[model samples]
Target: MPLIRYRTGDLGRLLTEPCGCGSQFCRLDRVKGRIAFRSALPSVYDLEELLYGMDTVLDFSARKEENKLCIQVLLAEGGTIGPVREAIEARFPDALVSVSSTLCLVSTGKQLIN
Candidate 1:
């Protein structure tokens, strides 16, 4: 047997604080969302799975603005935006996430004046 180097792409939080149960080992928080890899964001299908899978995500459209990645989404009723932002930011730190009712599309579909 060997130590597998496979990445599960499962997103979770590392808990450093001591627990009340007196467990010595650090705990891994429940899975929040998933990404493609540790160094890069997920693929289109993976992004779809990650976004649409969330209860907060109702509709979405992605576009690349130079080095910036943007995802505009519509949320379900009473769904807070924090979790949606976190789910995206946690996986793709480079993304400039903006969740709003407005879905804007560039006419040229290209970065102008860049």
Candidate 2:
């Protein structure tokens, strides 16, 4: 096989440092966003990582409404809303986070936004 560079549209960092497990091979950091979603502002990939990092969030979608960001989330059973709202606020100071039982999905069944 020949070496080729392919664009996967994922945005992330490459780690050069050895891992705590003692592996020296470089590792790609968590994907931050897709190239198609690139913009002058913070990438939605970062926000997705933050929301999904929470144990309760089952799914989520985010959109810009006027001057504020609206985040709708689906929670796991017995999930609480406070933490999700806090995480989004902390990361995006100006955003308005809303917790919901359902979020719209595309035809492919993926969450509509990031």
Candidate 3:
């Protein structure tokens, strides 16, 4: 049997060297953001699924900050910021959701920027 390689169009660094942890398989590092900027936003119909896909996202408070729809996502993990940002845009194409460097009043975790 042979394995099929799927082109995910993901922007990342593929490590060819063996891992220090003793794993011989290749590792993909810094798997950040959407594969393509154009595909960052998902379809409107799948908005709900996108929104809930993030593990760190907790709650959100939206407001107009300098004419932009600023959103603060209360997250469980700070690393999920990117996914949250993409999901919000996909969910609300008409509205823009930008994140602030400062964490939500609740805690210091993930935040998304439009």
The most accurate candidate by lDDT is 2
Compare the candidates by TM-score and give the number of the best one. 2
- Decreasing TM-score order of the candidates: 2, 1, 3
Query: Across residues 14-57, which tens digit of lDDT does each residue of candidate 2 receive?
Result: 77889989999987665545323224355555666798799999
Candidate 2 lDDT for residue 74: 90
Runs of candidate 3 with Cα error greater than 4 angstroms are 1-53, 94-114
Evaluated against the true structure, the overall lDDT of model 1 is 0.63
Ranking by lDDT: 2, 1, 3
For candidate 3, the TM-score is 0.35
Error of 1 at 102 (Å): 4.2
lDDT for each of the candidates? 0.63, 0.68, 0.49
How many clashes show up per model?
A: 0, 1, 0
List model 1 lDDT by residue over 27-86, tens digit each: 766544323343554544456668889988877767666666677777888988889889
Off by over 4 Å in 2: 1-40
CA RMSD, predictions in order: 11.6, 5.7, 13.4
Error of 3 at 6 (Å): 45
